[model samples]
Target: MSTVNDTKFSFAVFFLTGIPGQKDVHVWISIPFCLMYLISIVGNSVIVFIIKTDPSLHEPMYIFLSILAVTNLSLSISTIPIILGIYLFNSREISLDTCLAQLFSIHFLQCTESSVLLLMAFDRFIVIHDPLRYASVVTLPRIAKMGLVCVLRAVAVVVPLLFLLKRFQYGRANVLSHSCCLHQDVMKMVCSDITVNNIYGLFVKILTMGLDSLLIFLSYVMILKTVMSITSHTESIKAQNTCVSHLFAVIVFYTPEISLSVLHRFGKGSFPLIQILLGYITLLVSPVLNPIVYSMKSKHLHANIIKAFFK
Candidate 1:
């Protein structure tokens, strides 16, 4: 019902979602996110540096792994700093422009991560099914192109959501349960009809989240099939070893995300703190685990991280 020109440019809005909690709650939560952010940056940075610097890992799998690590870095960089500000300053306020921009970047990084994950799955499939062709097929040019595609796909759709949001009237201002900007938070105040927004969001989930997950599942299935066909026990073991770490990282990252979605929809009576913690665990906390999972599973990476820290 609202027009573009009628939408007000919001000054600043508070971000404290849910009923305000005690000082101890803020301290405890902030400390955890701060530490996780530090670890995530250092871990993902070293993974990227190692992948770039080491000639031994110049293969397609490691290249995609490096890309994934970098994407995680992007995710962490955007979410954690704003969250830290909200907690430390006790000021959850964000400008309307800033909020939309943050939403844009968050979705961009998220979609990029999802698409990159799918591409990595395809990379695994190629490595397993046609090891000889992987280096040529997933070359730097192709990888770069795929990266562009992923980022473009992400930005293309999310930018429009802002226009859609702009069509809504801001009946209320500055009431967020969480520390950072989220789609649900922004939409909560819309006095106009938001059924279309919900539909668009659903479509996105089905296409990006659901479709990407299916491709990843299929890629692993093909990979498992190819692995099973290998006769040499030692080579078979070595072949599977390369992909197992990536597989583990994927499971850890997505499982919590899926669970959080289901819970938020189904668990209406859940406590405020519990819901907040789960949401953060799904996005912010999950990223911290990606590099750790990779390093723990990769002997070379584990050794390098340890050596780097010690030195």
Candidate 2:
């Protein structure tokens, strides 16, 4: 552990980071993450461009898709650049301020993306349950308002949580086990009592992750009920298909996130290598999976993707 210098410029935070066992292992890990990062950038960039350029896709769902694409782009960029930097250079040292900044941005963007997904759920519910009045209800002004609210919600919730975390006094150890600065890894550097931080972390998970997921589940429940009441078999089938892609994307997003959180809390120090490996894998998989999942499983999105590519 390094000491925090009283003089600002003299301060250098040493991170506790893991190195791949062999050169071969480093290459293997680096290769996949590199590919995922590339594909995610291209896929998400195309989605944003297509949505912006296509007049027909000016609807609520496409707008949300565009939002998700941009979020995914930023989220993955924030993570992978640092991850790749570590892998290539084996640099583990990070300043306290830099680590904290990374922690805040990582959580801020990731949680913002999750909030957007919740809004997408509501958008789907409106489209399916009341298609007749969908246009009237989801007017342009209303869409803008909803978008603003979602942004504010994510910032409002995550900003305070992160600011509160900065209150914890930290030791000089800045090395992280994983590529990027995960909250848990950074929190472990705290020299002060972390009771307040832990409590607040719990509150954030309950409100942002737990509560958001619960609401998503409820939205789908209501969506299912509404679908069932309709006697038209084809309509129900279409509704089911429309939801399947989103369901896959949601599962891909939340399952690994929750698993990583649980593993950090309970499985610390038992298998650090396994944990870091899984952390890197999850970070690579979650954002990249969305575009692939949507393209493969969603006919409408696939068509749009094809048209965009060809054009």
Candidate 3:
């Protein structure tokens, strides 16, 4: 048990845990993780490259997609080093500073991704609800400003978490539940009073992800209403189809997050392996799947992907 002094400074070195009870198979497990990381990097990079190089793909939707791709790439890059180190090299020890940095990066990127998704939802709604005015409403400059706001908002919300955490002394066991450091996982290791941290953390989550989700839901409802009011059934279906890829992206991003929250709150006695696996899904799956979802669903993007790769 490592201890910190009254200065609120921690010299503690935290050990990241891999899948519980799977030490012997960690090497084998790393293979699939490596593949997923590779796919995430390559897929998101291709998406970004296609969007950047093609003049036709410079619209608000594709610009937003490029931002999402960059976010996914950063998210994956932040976690891959620690995860692969743990599974492949059995390098599980992470310094307190490094752990806090990882925690900040993961949460910040998650919030930014949520904001981007909400922006995408808004984009789709505008396109469907008022196609003629979308050009004036959702211009490239406005999209750039929105993207900047998302990043700055995430920083403002998540940076305080570091200060809140820094005031604590993590004298208890420093073994984190997941290979990557999460705010909640790190919070659990603190031996000091955590009431403020808990309250503030919850507040940030609600303000950022929770609020974004509600607005996204409302946007979709309005979209549905507009689509229904359209007299042509084919047009309604076409409008609905525009959202399928984004819907998949939302599901891919949020399902694991929701599951992990439920697991942490109610499934305390659940299997440790299950907990770790869910954590991996939360961190890894969105980056791995988002590009594939868009590539398969968007005809323009799909064609470009083929041209870039196959031709």
**If scored against the real structure, what TM-score would every candidate get?**
0.88, 0.90, 0.95
**Tens-digit lDDT track of model 2 for 23-58:** 456656667778989999988887788778878778
- Compare the candidates by TM-score and give the number of the best one: 3
Ranking by lDDT: 3, 1, 2
Which candidate number has the best lDDT?
3
Residue range 61-115, candidate 3, lDDT tens digits: 9999999999999999999877999989999988888888999999999999999
For model 1, how many clashes? 6
Evaluate candidate 2 by giving its C-alpha RMSD to the native, one decimal. 2.8
**Each prediction's number of clashing residue pairs:** 6, 6, 0
- Collision pairs in model 3: none
Query: Which parts of model 3 are misplaced by more than 4 Å?
Result: 1-9, 266-271
Rank all candidate structures by their TM-score, best first, as comma-separated numbers.
3, 2, 1
Which residue window of length 10 is worst by lDDT in model 2?
A: 1-10
TM-score of model number 3: 0.95
Off by over 4 Å in 2: 1-12, 16-20
Worst 10 residues of 3 by lDDT: 1-10
Alpha carbon lDDT of each predicted model = 0.76, 0.76, 0.89
TM-score of candidate 2 on Cα atoms, chains taken together: 0.90
